[model samples]
Target: MFKKKVVSLALVITILLLSIIGCTSPQAQKQEENVLEQEWKEVIASAKGTEVNFYMWGGSRTINQWVKGYVAKNLKEKYDITLNMVPMDATDFVNKLLGEKQIGKKEGTIDLLWINGENFKTAMDNELLFGPFADNLPNYNRYMNTDSKQITTDFGFPTKGYEAPYSKAQFIFIYDQNKIEKAPYSFEELIAWVKSHPGKFTYPALPDFTGSAFVRHVIYEITGGYEQYYNLEDEAEIRKKIRPALEFLADLEPYLWREGETYPSTIAQLDNMFADGEVLMSMGYDPSKATSEIVKGTYPDSARTFVLESGTISNTNFLAIPFNSPNKAGALVVANFLESFEAQLSKYNPENWGALPVFSYDKLNDQEKEELADLDLGIATLSQEVLDKHSVPELPADLVPIIEDEWNKIVGK
Candidate 1:
């Protein structure tokens, strides 16, 4: 009878153990999966009918129209989300975010931000951004080549899923074929060209995006190369490395427009001067800008784009959400939609924004591929083959501000 009791007790313990195992195994996994799905659904539901304030550079009318007209319309119609386009410089927005953080403001007005490079680094370093959310976007997973270094890194800093690529840009110099028979294809030739054509060439003042890029390009050409500065963190070492480029600029000052005593305050001013025949050369961060301006009657028919023989800096711009954004779900919805085929194609249209598409060709469907192939990229635009052959990565983000500051103290003075 004791043996029977012992067997019965063993059977009861075995049944209880089995029950516990069942509860802790597949059942628990199913419960977790259900919770995730419910969370995603809740996000979608919350996003509906909410407004997302998108803060970005409002300098370009075309870009602003693309956002306010096409993007806003699409978001409203498709997702019931209102995209409020807020025109603010990235630096100003960063300052504003810093202020909010100082006050312990948990909810910020900025939902989406168009940012890249140093500004992105500043925001990320300050814990001001709201992601790891780029992977959550369906279009990003479907169309983006996340493995590509250009997409994965910004200014030599790892993106780590904090930002989604919005567009690609390459630095190119624009010159009038009518004024000069052949464009200079190297830094040495550029200096000689500027010397020969005294008071005819000058970049915009420092802090202007294109002007700053041009300086970096000069540094890349004059000071060894771009690769060395990618991992080197010593500020003094960097300042020493880029000194030749600054000295070169100082040497070239005499031949520059207005004798380099003053420079056009903005790229647009430089473009205008070039258009008005006051300057023979102007540079732009956008490869398509020259062509687009030509079409708009802002540039002469003789305007042409060219890159240096060594290569020009090319980088991808990205969109990011701030950590304290009031409408994270709405921002995600907009970001996902921006990566869609239709929106990308629209943005690629020179008439719309003239921004290059960030979509991977292999990932696109056959119809989408054909559509991209058939699009006219304008007569002034360089072929993708040519652009790719002469493209180089940008300098590290940390080094950029140092370069700018040094330029201000040395060259800009």
Candidate 2:
């Protein structure tokens, strides 16, 4: 009887242990399998013998040449993809694609774009983009935060990863460092400097992003906040608060380029004048632009970039595939490469072309940053520390048009 009892108790304990093990083992296996599948999916197969037509802003010859270099080397060497740059005013491309959509031409003539702001919003609204495909890129998992998703979500849209952020740009001031003893650290100080120097400072006219950004920059400085300024929509309230900003511009009109009657036709003209010693300062989106110009003998080597003490603004530019793009997969492959750390580093290396990278550098381990840090960046570029001092500017959807019209009226043309 004692032996029987002992045997029965041992059997019960054995059955319980087996039951627990059986339950947990399958769950563990399932989790491991899911992770393995994800890892495998991330290794995108290269698109061989594919041609991608990249539609980009071709306003600058240097940028166009650089894109050609990308085609001749990077895409061909790695993915066996061919790149053709389709230069058009970004608006023209948008209109063409929209027309195609109306006529039921689902497959598009263009594959990629260097895009942001209103353009991005328009594309998203039309449901004209390729994928929530960014996740498939191996590098996507390493980003610092997913709130970068906010960019897609807030625009009354979904990203589906159809767009991959490629580079970052900000409104920055370029000054002749040899002549300007100390760069103005704040908007107030900048005003003071201009007053003292008289006719030495000016910004581009609106309707241009670079020019419109100047208004946003000033508004952000005086508003003392970002969210409220970005969300402001009430026309009356907008005009009321914006009055101070507009008045500031009107007040400074006497000291502007060509006495404010004729501002530089575009940011490019302003940059050129700054290069020629015709002006004391200029503004640019690509912080490395002035440095690049200097290298090309378009500007003097003494120019330096600075952010106001009030802080400048930053926003990411992205590459997106139009939904109608027949070569969707190829475009994704190219965009993935463009957003890769290797490509971004090369493009933004200050000396290389100096567009700030959109990828979060903080996610890069110390070793990666250090490896990238040693590249030969150009002189007069902002150091990493100085660059970090600036803030991202998010302008309201309606604001640009209002400011542009107001500027046209102010300019009386």
Candidate 3:
């Protein structure tokens, strides 16, 4: 009886000690996690009635409408949160974050950020983001395939929960089927098509994201594959490894539109060239862009998109919180909401935004799977099955500048 009393006293003391140091029993932690106690519930409570400033590229009218209309309305009605979207270029907002970081400002205007690829790398490198928070989000924990490579990395850099994926995007070459019956299925075939049809094919110049991606695809084909460069950090080595791609580009220049003297400065210009029949093909990172353009009447009904047989590059755009956000809790709430099934579904619909959802088919409930199946991806868009089978990962963010700069040198020479 006395030994049992001593054991009980010892247990009580250990529990008291754990509580004092903010530690808890494993069972207690599990119980707390099951209910989303202080960790998430408190965040939601703190977030209510606060305004979250969302800074993003507002280039698309439809994206802006979805944000200001659907997203904002839902937040207001359900969460009692006000979402303020600030329309700005990615570069401009990144600069704003840099400025704030330099001044050591503890509270800033930006609560959430929309960025991906090199920009995400820059933000993370500068410590301008507020996370590891994505893993803590309720929707992220429930519906996200946290283990998937697509969500774990951004442009080959480990995300580590600094951001949550907003949507899936893949590179596709767009062509008018009425003009060309068959789309090229490989870089060699594409090169042959370009040579056969002189002055009918051209990509936007270097430094343009789409043009840079096109160049990267060429490098991937010429340099063997993308796996070797995963750990390759040296710029000079990358330059040497990709020299063949540079030469290949230079050699192909003579067959390009305008005899390789110049290229379109922007993707919009390339699309215009395609529309006017000056160019036979255009390309975009957005998988559904071809369909959206077709819907806009910019391309004929026969216009369509396709990936190369060897696959094309793909990436995830992400939402992040600024490090010094005035409303960190609210930002977290909003970011969580963006990753919710309803928001992802709305964003996937063609009439809405047409961006692809990030959730895996297996991760979604049967109802969610049904909803996703019911929605059409539109005629001009490539089927999701084809896209998944042929998807390639993006080059690491650090390597992009080397490739882009080298291509510029090749162009200049």
Cα deviation at 366, candidate 2, in Å, is 2.2
lDDT of 1 by residue, 1-413 (tens): 99999999999987775554323344323322342244555656667898999999999888999899999999999889999999999999999998877756656678899999889999888998876888878889888888877788899998999899899888999999998999999888988999999999999888888899999998988888888987797889889999999998988899999899998999999999999999999998888988889988999988999999998989999999887676777788888889888999999888788787887776888898788878788878885557766878888877878888988888898
Q: What is the C-alpha local distance difference test score of each model?
A: 0.85, 0.69, 0.85
Q: Report the Cα lDDT for residue 354, model 3.
A: 86
RMSD of each: 12.2, 16.1, 11.1
| Residue lDDT tens for model 3, 1-413 | 99999999999987765554434345323332342234788777778888889999999999999999999999999899999999998889988889877855555678899988788888888998877778788888887778766788998988989889899998999999999989999888999999999999999998899999999999899999888888898878989999899889999988999988999999999999998889999999988988888888998788889899999998888998877676777888898999998999899888888887776666777887778778899898876557767888888878888888888888745
Residue-by-residue lDDT tens digits, candidate 2, 266-288:
88988887877788999877777
Cα-based RMSD of candidate 3 = 11.1
TM-score of every prediction relative to native = 0.76, 0.76, 0.81
Q: Looking at candidate 2, what is the lDDT of residue 325?
A: 63
Off by over 4 Å in 2: 1-43, 46-51, 58-65, 80-89, 106-110, 143-145, 148-160, 207-209, 253-265, 272-279, 350-352, 407-413
lDDT for position 79 in model 1: 89
- Candidate 1 local Cα displacement, residue 69, angstroms: 2.6
Backbone steric clashes in candidate 2, count: 6
Candidate 1 residues lying further than 4 Å off, grouped into runs, are: 1-51, 58-61, 87-109, 186-200, 205-208, 250-269, 276-279, 360-366, 383-389, 404-413
